[model samples]
Structures are given as structure tokens and as C-alpha cells.
Target chain A: MNVPLPNADHLVGIVFLIMIGLTITGGVIACNANRLVRAVAGLVVCFVGVAGLYYFLNSPFIAMMQMLIYVGAVAVTISFAIMFAAPEESKKHGPPGTLAGPFGLITAGLLFGGFTLLALKTDWQVHAKINDGSVETMGKLLLTEYAMVFELISIVLLTAIIGALIIARRGRSS
Target chain B: MEILSLYNNLNTFLIIGALLFSMGVYGLVTRRTLIGMLIAAELILAGASINFMAFNRFTAPDPQVGQIFTLFIMAIAAAEAAIGLSIVVAIYRNYKSIDAEDLVELKG
Candidate 1:
């Protein structure tokens, strides 16, 4: 193998920064877009950026699921709903309430500030890992330790799909 | 140089999670439509998942626990989106509009 360059770490850092920028920018677009379709597009972008962050966090499995589920399934579903609902063009431009915009900004800002302070100030205790959180370990745990939760999630998904179909099908003219 | 190694630090991930959470809150509060609110809710869930994974990587003794929890969260979020979108569709079918302001039947 060729010798690694000293500046390779810096390049990785730059890429991380770029991913952060992508996430924040996408989030801003998702929140501020006037068109619902545009907002969904922003959501897809934000999710992709988040998947990058997951890769950085050392879990490629979760990252792949993030992209597959959030970007592929969820975003597409939202867009389809938008197409079905057919929101009026004129009404889609305004905030929900008169004070909602400023009040929301203030509330979110305060939350962000508080969380940042808490994260920075508190000394979080780190513990030694019993096993590497690799894909193999995760698979075993899902079948063994987390089996109950896994089954419960499947049940929830089943109910959700059935409920969604029923709800959407009700009051149809046909 | 320190900035380059920021990914190894826990605080960096925490701050990113906070940012995503706040953006989601803002979107949820200010959106004028149900689907918009749902999108924001997904952002909120994403932020929570990030925090969980971050802690899983950095702090927790049993690293797999947080991953499992995050996976569970994703499952729940998918279910929520399905139900919510269907509800939005139903409301639209009845009202012929999905605007949050127009659904004020109980606005006494």
C-alpha cells in the first residue's frame, strides 16, 4: 500500500464540513420553501446529508437504511400525498398564523441554544464497549436481545399499512 | 488542525443533532399544511436518531443498544408517515383542501 499523505485527514475534515453544510442548507430549504414539492426535494437532500453523518458515526447499516427509508420511501410518500391532496397554489405561500413565523423562530432558536449549551457543558461519561457494533453483532442482537422490539415494529408497520388503506379508502364516492 | 479532527468529538455530533431538531421544530410550527408539518416531524425524528447513534458510538457501553433504538425509531417514523399521509388524504377528500387553517370545525 502507498504511504498515506499527512494532509489526507484534513481532506476528510473538509468533506465532513461540506456534509454538514449540505445538511443545514437542505434543512433550511425544507423549512422555507414555498412549494410543497420543493420542500420534499429539500427533505431528500437533507436525508442524504444525514446519511453521510451516519457514515461518519461508524454505522454504515443505519446510514444505508436512512437513505433507503427516508429518501426513497418517506419522501416519495410525502410527494405522492401532496399530489393526491392537491393543495391550492395561492394558499401554500403564507405562514399558518400571523405570529407563527417569529414565534417559531424564537422557540427553535432557544431550543438550539439550550441544547448546544447542555452538550458543551455537561461531561458525558464514556464506557467500554462489550462488542464492536458491527453489522454481524447488530444482526445477532436483533434476533436475540431485541427480538421482542423487532416483532413489535413489524406489528406496528402492519397496522399502519392497514390503517392507512382503510382511512384513505373511507368516504370514497365509488 | 483541531477542526479537522472534530468528527471524533462527541460535542460536534450533539450540536448537529440540536440544529436538525430546532429546524424541525420551526418547520412544524410555521407550516400551513398537514403534509408540511409531517415533513417537519420527520426532520425531528431524524435529529433524534442522530443523537441516538452519536451516543451509541461515543458513550454507551453496549453500542448495539442505541443502534437498535434508532432502528426502532426509523420503523416508528415510517409507520407514522404512512398513517399521517393517509389522514391527510382523507381530510383532503372531505374538505377539498389540506390547509391547516381551514380545518377549524371546532373553533368556537
Candidate 2:
């Protein structure tokens, strides 16, 4: 088998490795960090790395949206919630019971191992190309094929906004 | 194997996504505070999006479907976050603490 490796391919591989590192490291920090603010920072880092991976997946638009919506909007909103709702410092530590330590680790490790094995063992089939999956094509499909779902999502967004407002407003009268 | 071409491969993305998912699960199980659990949930959603994108890149005939699905996930996550944070705020107002253990009381 004569397979030519382009110079760009190597660069992409390195970047991919770096992104994976970023994602995993940030995930660790997000999960393990003691401080809430640090956890938020880790979340931001992980989201950024995920965005990079999306770019590699050939959807730069989604990559940008991932960064914008997740890292920008979601992370920022979470940080704001932390600032407002959380105390100045998290001193009230929960009793880390006997099982919390080893059990959590074992569970997460088993899950990760299982998924990794599944991904490696499965021989996924590639289907014929229907479209290039560009932003233009996505727009067309959204309007034509997925119009109902698209509209429903918008309705969901509206309801979420209203519900959030109502929920937040409830305590003022009490 | 060259470093850059790693993105071209499917297994790398799958492994990374799984790792993220595991971390999220660990956090969800271990975190004491609601906000921390929310962060973990976000990580889990991120993992799902990665899997969708990877499948789109490698196996899907219409790649745009995965992209659109990811976008929908993002929108849902945003909405969820908004509502969840609001609920957190309300809970904090009632209990004066955001810790999960503190807000265990139920009213009749």
C-alpha cells in the first residue's frame, strides 16, 4: 500500500494531539479542582479545546459557535452564577465518605476503558456522500428538511428564557 | 505517524471524547456543589458533541447533519444553563447556600 503523507498532515496530527491534551487536562482540572473559580477556568479551557477538535472535524462554523456559545456565553454565565450565588469561599466541605474516593475513580476509569475499547473494536462503515456538509448546505437542510425541529428548538429557547426569568423572580415576593 | 494527521483519524477523537465523558461522570459523582455538577454536565455534553462531529467527519454521508445536531446541542445546553442557573439562584436565595447537601429541605 503506497500512501503519501503530506506535510500538512503531520501538522494536523500534532495539533490534534495538542487539542486532546488540552481537553483531557482541562477536564481533569475542571473535575478535580477544589476551588469553584478554578473549576470554571478549567471548563473554559476544555470548551476551547473541544472547539479546536470541532474545527478538525471539518466544521469550522460549528467550531466557532462552540467557542462563542460555550466558552463565551455558557462559561461566562456560569462564572456569574458562581459570583452571585456562591459564598466568598467554599469552606463548607462535604464529608468525603469512605466510598467517595476509590469508588468514583473506579467507576470513571471503567467507563473510560469501556468506551475506548468499544471505539477501537468497532469497525464503522462509511456511507456515500450526500453533501459536503458546508454551512450553505446546512442552511438549506435546516429550512427544508429540519424546519419543524428548528422551529421547535426556537420555541424551546423562548420557553427556557421565560421560565428562567420566572424562576429567578419567585423569591422577591416571598 | 505524523502529529498533524491525527485529526484525520477517527480513533483519536473517539478516545478523547470518551475521556471527557469519564471525567464528567467522575465530577458529577464527586462534586458537592450544584455549580460544580453543572460544570461536569457541560463536559459530558461536550463529549457527545465530539462524538457526533467525529462520526460526521469519518462515516456520515451528510456531514452537515452532525454539525447541525451539534449546533442544536449547543442551543439546548445554553437554555439548560440559563434555567439551571436561575434555579440555583432561587435555591440560594431560599437556603443561603449553594451546596447540594444544604438544600435538602422540602416544603409541604
Candidate 3:
């Protein structure tokens, strides 16, 4: 096939690779950091990268939601929780179990290897399109086909907020 | 060369999802505190969402389904983080420590 030398696709691919790097680095920091706040920061970076991935997957709406929900709502909530409840440095000096870290690493590596193999070997099937999966169609489906779930999720969020308030405010009156 | 074309391949996304999942597993297993575990849980959710998005992009007939599913996952994750963090606060209040190992009051 005729093509330009080092085309636009190559630039997009390099950007994709950079996103992958950012994602993995964020994940590593989130898991391996010495402090909790740093882990939350890493989680934010990772979620941003994942949002970029969603954009590449042809779901800009989902990407925006990922950014709003994960990076905006979830990460911020986790950081607030850390601020309120994280243990002080002075209390963390006790010796930890020696085997826990190494064992966890080995288990994660094995799991990763198995999953990679499964993903590579599996013969995924493709089907004909019902719709173009556009924003307008998604909105229609969300209101029509998936209306019940949409409503239920709202209820769930309401309950979560209420429950969080009750639980966090339990001991404050003393 | 051909390596740059990896972005269009489903396998690439799947492998990335697997790696994210493994990182979550490692964090969950190794983290000593409840918030740390929660962070890892979010990572796991993210990986699952990526897998869904990949399959949606590559194979699904109704691509909206996976996007919708991923949105639901995000909603659930938001709820989970809220409830979990509140519980974490409660636990810290009761036990004065957020470490998972310190939560042995019910071990008997």
C-alpha cells in the first residue's frame, strides 16, 4: 500500500506509547510510594492516562466521565480521607512482616503472565453493529433501554453520600 | 515501523489492562492500610473498564453497551470510594490506626 514516509499515524502511535508509559509509571508510584498522599497523586495521573485511552477507543464521553468521576470525584475524595485519617509518621515505625512484599510481588507477576497469555490466545468474536454508538444514541439508550440502571445509580450515589455523612459524623459530637 | 500500529490492535489494550490489573493485585496484597487497598481497588476497576472499552471498540455490535457499562462502573466506583472512605474514617476513629493488621478486634 502507498503511504507517506513516517505519517500522522506514527505520531499518534508515539503519543499512545507515551500515555502507556505515564499510565504504568503512575500505577507503580501508586502502589510503591512511601506515603499515602503521593499514592493518591499517582492514582490521579493514572486515571488521566486511562481517560486518554478511552478517547483513543472512540468514547470521548466516557473519557470525560472518567476524568470527572475518577480524577475529580474519586481521587479528591480519597485525598480528603487521607487528610482526615492518615496515620502519623511517628506511629508507623514498627517492623513489618518480611515476606509480605516479596510474596505479593510474585503473585502479581504470575497473575499478569496468565492474563497476558489468555488475552493473546483467546479468539475474540466480532458482531454486526446495532448502532454507531454515538453520543446521541447513547443518550437515547440511557434514557430508554437502560433507564432503570441510570436511576438506580443515582439512588446509590444518594445513599452513599448520606451514609458517608452519618459514619464520618458519628464521633464528632463528643 | 509496524510496532506503531500496535495502537489499533486489541491485544495491545488487553495487555495493558492485564498489567494494570496486576499492579492492582500487587497493591492490594502488599498495602498495609485500608486507603491503600482502596486505591488498588480503583486500579482494578480501571483495568476492567479498559477491557470493556477495548472489546467495545473492536468487537461489540452495540458499542454503546460497553460505554454504558463503563459509566456504570464509574458510578459504582464513586459510590464505593465514598462509602469506603467513610468506613476508613470510622475505623480510624475506633481503632486509632488505619493499618489492616491492626483490625483484629473481631479475629476471635
Candidate 4:
């Protein structure tokens, strides 16, 4: 039995709007928060909303990876660094440069306006899809056509791990 | 209504990407700490990734390429975060503070 849901499309649209709201709200919190921990929390929220955006973009695998790599690993690592560095509350409460806030806002506003105009004015062309962009296709391409870059990424990750350990471990014995 | 179908629109994604990118720029400019700058940098990268994914979904001839590119972006972001945080730790240990203004030792 096919029951027609009249408002389903509208509901989905509302959900998308909510996701956008979540993303922007989190970004504002992350950028504007005075406390580092609160900023990190905002980062987490923003990433979650980005993951939802990825879902809307029709790539569930990338969305899951966004959650796993960004929210899980990156955000947690940042919080760990926050704990290690311990940015003091008293120190952070000092005044910022007089022109920094307004200057940054103006810069960002100009950038946003320019990009929005570009996106709106340009006639984006749609092309025919060769593959469905599924996990299977992604895996095959990763191992075949893009194998070199894949291997290189792994090497880079290894180097980063070793380098990070060495750098963070320095001056410990003194 | 047409607004109800905004998810299918390419401009929507592009606008969102632009918004995020600008926010990142604002954050990077205004933030006073190295780690905060790093976070803003991550936001910038995320905005770029979203644009790639949007183009992949709407316009690309081969969808796999964009997804692959985004995956590589994620890997690089992870590595960057690891390296950047470690550096933050090292800087804190040496200077005993992570404030960007305090590290102006070369202001000769």
C-alpha cells in the first residue's frame, strides 16, 4: 500500500535547514568563544553538522569518515592538547588588538559576499556520471587508478606520527 | 515550493561552503592562540572539502574522483592535526605559554 505523504518533502527541507543552522551556530560558537574548551566543543558540533551535510550530499561513507576522523580523532586530539597546554583563564581574559575584530569581520564579510555572488551568477554545468560513486567503486579506484596517492597518504601519516612523537617528546628529560 | 527542494540545488551547497570558508578566515584572523588558528585552518579545509563534494555530487563526470579527493583530504587533515597539536605542546613547554603575542622574541 502506497500511502502518499504530502508533507514529506517539506519535512526533509526543514531538516536540511536545521542542519544548516546547526553548522553555522557551531561555527559561530567555535570562533567567538573565549574559552578554548568551549571552542573545541563547538568544533565538535560543527563537525557533526558537516557530517550531516555530507549525508545530504549522497556520500554516506564520506560522512561516516568525517565523523570518525574529524569528530572522533581530530577533535579529541585537540582537547588532549588543550589539557596538556592548559591555556590559563586569566591569561586569555586580556584585551585583543583594537582593530582585529572589526578588520576580521570586514574581511570575512567581503569574502562571503564575493563567493555568494560567484556561486549565484555562474552557470554550473552538470556532466554525465561514469560511476555511481559507491563504496565498491571507491575501493576499486583507490587500489587501481589512485593507488600511488593512497600509498603516499599512508606514508605521510606515518611520518606525521613519528614526527609528532619526536617533537612533543623533546625537552622532557630536562 | 521551490525552497523545499533546496537540497537538490547546487547553489545551496556552494553558498554553504563559502560561508564556512569566510567564517574560518574570520576565526584565523581574530584568534590569538596557535591552536585556535589551527582549528580555524581545519574549518577552512572543511569548507574546501564541502565544495569538492558538492561539485562531485552535481557536476563531476566521475563521482569517484571527488570522494577519493575528500578521503585524501581527511587523511591529510588528521595528520595535520596530529602534527599541529604536538607542535602546540612543544611550544607551550618551551615558552610556558601558548599565546601568539608572547612568542614575539624576534621583534628586534
Candidate 5:
């Protein structure tokens, strides 16, 4: 029996490269853009690309969840924040005393170079699989092994929702 | 050595994760607005997720565990975003602007 290899065709390879490009470009735009709204837009693009990477990682369920939660919900929330709380234009380019563009670039470059070296030099070991990482397996584990954490997360989400409403609703009689 | 075939390697994903993380660091430090910093923080979270997923695909014995961890990270990020945005709104309501520099009453 022959198992088919993923991304063996050249077309998938090209698409992977394109997704990488999109991720990098979107990250640059999100971080470096002058306007806040544009930065949010960039973030949406970046999250979409990250979802694509999840697909490539052989986790389609996670990929769809990534797109739904991050790109769809989180990005929309940030854009809404931008619309409601648009920052002032005065001295928007740089803060008062902290380091600016070049220093940031240098620092990020050093970090990137260091991490790349580490990744390339280290030999990652593979282990035997317990399951095929299918959606069914994930669901079963979510209810069996990780049920407590799942319930706790729901509670946390509820608390966050209430806390947000209370904090934002205060001091309204100005 | 072949760039096109990089999709098949664990190191490739690790390198990309590292890049995303460094970009987040850069954005966090250089951004002057609250929203920009939040966006950078999201990038950092994404980088961490990618790292976990990469390790899961290549090294971990149980792949579902990593996906579970990533799902939790997504949940935490969502809650953080909601609370952070609400705080930003409150700050804007009080100061009439969302610039980090303007909200410096507690400065030493």
C-alpha cells in the first residue's frame, strides 16, 4: 500500500510560498503602518495567512477555527476599537523618549537572526503517534481529558464579558 | 537548499514562527498607540501557536494535545482582546484620545 505524500506537487509548494509572503507582508503592514485602521487591516491579513499555515500543518479543524475566531471575530473587534477610539494625530509617528524606527528594526532583525540560527542548528526528534490528529480525536479529548479546562474557559469568557461591560459603562455622567 | 520544498520541513515553520515573534516585539516597542500594541501582542500569541503546532506535527507523540493548547490560546486571546478593547474605549471616553502618551497621570 502506498501512502500519498502531501505537497508533493509543485502547485502546493508555490501556494505555500505565497502564503508565507502574505504573512510577512501583512505583519510588516500591521507593525509599521502609520495609521491605526490600516494596521488593523494588516492584522486581518496576517491572521488569515496564519490560518493557511495551520491548514498546511495538517490540522484543518484548527485552521477553520483560527479563521473564524481570529480573522473574523478578533480582527473585527480591533477594527471596532479603532472606529470608536481613534487616536489623536498629534505626534503620532513616534513616542516622546523611547527608541524609534531604526532601533526597532535592528532589535527585530537580531531576534529573527538568532531564532533562525537556533532552529536550523537544533535537531528536532520525532515521536510515535498516538492518534491521527483527526477532528473526532480532538473532540473526544476535549470532552474527556480536557473537560475541566473547557468549562473553566467558558467561565472565564463570561467573567470577561461582564467585566468589560462594567468597566466601560462606568463614569458616564461626565 | 530548495526554497520551494521548505513546506515539508519542521525548521521552516520554526523559522517563520520566530520571524512572527520578532515582528511582534518590534511592533510592541515601536508602536505609540494602544491598538497597535494590542495588534503586536496578537502577533506574539500567533507566533507561539505556530511554534506549538510545528512541534506537534514533527515531534510530539500526541498531536491533539497541541491543537487543544492552541485552541485554549485562541480563547485566551479572544478574552484579552475584549477586555483590552473595552479598556481602550473607557480610556478614550475619559481622555478624548487613545494615545498612550496622553494617559500619563501616574507618571513618576
Candidate 6:
């Protein structure tokens, strides 16, 4: 199967590099933006880029789910929260503390750089695989091996739904 | 050394996860409002999910394990967001402001 592998591989590599850049840039924007709503917008951009990376990782199902849940549902919810609660000023910068803002930025930057160095320097081992991580295999394993977790998550979701209802409704009475 | 090719490696995902986690941590520490903190918490959950997915793709005996675990994390994060938002709503009703600085009546 000597099918001119380098060309295809390099193309994929370029695409992957672009996706990684998009994700990192969006994340930087999300964390560092001056306005809260713009930060939320950056988060949506980051999530969409991460979904692209998931597709590159050979799990299209997870990638699609990532888009649906994070970009579609979660981002919308966060934007709604912003609309209702966050400040409308586009250039408020930050809170009133003098030293806190710069200190927080430097701390986050250091942590990110340290992690990048560690990840680049270390050698990782990949062990044998039981399955190829396909959607069919994922479904079978979910139903067969992780059934208990599936049921527990359903319960958790139900509780969250009820709790959200009660908490939001409590304000209506007053 | 093809280090820049780190973009194609599993460790790249791990490093990205760590970056996201630290951003979340920074946001959690610095945000003045409850909803902003909630957004940061979601970022932290996302970082954890990315780690699980990366390990699943690279090292695990059963690759589906990580995917399943990530799915569960997503469910949990959604639930957490719903509950957290509701609480924020209630707190806003009670306090008239959602600023973390203002909701300090319980402080001694």
C-alpha cells in the first residue's frame, strides 16, 4: 500500500496545524478579552475549533456532538446569560483593583508556557488498543461496559432539570 | 528535531488541555461575577474532556472508555450549567446584583 503517503500526510498535517492555531488563538482571546460578552464570543470560537480537531482525531461522531452541545447549546446559554446579566460596556477592561489584573494575566501566561514546555519535552508511550475507537464500538461499550454510568448521568440530568426549575421559579413568587 | 510537528502529536492535545485548564483557573480567580465563574468552570470541564479523549486515542486498551467518559463529562457539565444559572437567577432576585463582591452578607 505504498500510495504516496507523504503528500497526503503533509496535507493533513497542515490542516491540523491550522486547526490548532485557531483553537489556541480563540482561547487566548476568550481569556484575555476586555469585555465579558466578547470573551464569551471567543469561547464559542474556541469550541468550534476544538470540534474541528476532534474530527481530525477520527471520531466524527464526537466532533459533531461537540459542535452541537458546546457551540450550539452551551454557547447560546452563555450568551443569554451575558445578555441578561453582564455589563454592556465594550471597553471596561477589568475590575477596579490596581495590581490584580496584571498579576492574573502573568500567572495564566506562565502556567500556559510551562505546560507547553512540558508537553513538548516529554516522551509519551502509546499502548495496545482493544478497539479502534469507532462510533459503533463506542455505543456497544457504553451500553455493555458503562451502563451504570449511563444511568447515573440520566439521573443527574433529571435532578439538574428539577433543580433549575425550582430555583428559577423561586424568584417569581417574590 | 521535528518539534514543531508537535502539532500532530497526542502531547499537543494534552498541552492544549493544560492551557485551557489554566485559563479557566485564572478566570475563576479573577472574575467578579457568578456567571463568569460558571463560564470558567465549563472551560475547566472541557480541558478534562480533552485529556480523556487524547489518552483514549493514544494509550488506552479500550479506546471507547475515554469517549464514553467524555460524554459523561459533557452531560455533567450541561447539568452543572443549568443548575448554576438557576442559582444565579435566584441570587440576583435576592440581592439585586450578581457581583461576587456584593453577595458577602454571610462573611464575618
Candidate achieving the largest DockQ:
1
On TM-score, the stronger of 2 and 3 is: 3
The 0-to-1 C-alpha lDDT of every candidate, in the order given, reads 0.88, 0.86, 0.88, 0.88, 0.86, 0.76
Model 6 CAPRI rating: medium
* Tens-place lDDT digits, model 6, residues B1-108: 254355457888998888888887787777777777777787777777888888777777767777888888888888888888878777877887677778788485
Quick one: RMSD of model 5?
4.2
Q: lDDT per residue, candidate 1, A61-152, as tens digits?
A: 98899899998899999999998896564456786678999999999999999999999999988665533648999989999988998999
Ranking by TM-score: 1, 4, 3, 2, 5, 6
Error of 6 at A98 (Å): 3.7
Chain A of candidate 5 scores what in TM-score? 0.84
What digit string (tens of lDDT, one per residue) describes model 6 on residues A121-172? 8776776553454778788777888888889999999999999899878555
Candidate 2 lDDT by residue in tens digits, A85-122? 98664675444567776787899999999999999999
Going through the candidates in order, their DockQ values are 0.76, 0.71, 0.71, 0.75, 0.72, 0.53
TM-score, structure 4 vs. true: 0.93
The Cα RMSD of model 4 versus the native structure comes to: 3.0
State the weakest 10-residue window (summed lDDT) of model 1 chain A: A125-134
**Model 1, position A104: C-alpha lDDT score:** 99
- Candidate 2 segments whose C-alpha is farther than 4 A from its true place: A1-7, A93-95, A127-133, A170-174, B2-4, B106-108
Query: lDDT: which is higher, 1 or 5?
Result: 1
**After superposition, which runs of candidate 1 have C-alpha atoms over 4 Å from their true positions?**
A1-6, A128-131, A170-174, B106-108
Give TM-scores of the second chain, every candidate: 0.95, 0.93, 0.96, 0.94, 0.93, 0.91
Per-chain TM-score of chain A in candidate 2 equals: 0.86
Q: Ten consecutive residues with minimal summed lDDT in candidate 3 chain B?
A: B1-10
Residues A22-41 of candidate 4: C-alpha lDDT, one tens digit per residue: 78888887887888888888
| Candidate 4 residue-wise lDDT at A155 | 100
For candidate 5 chain B, the 10 contiguous residues with the lowest summed lDDT are B1-10
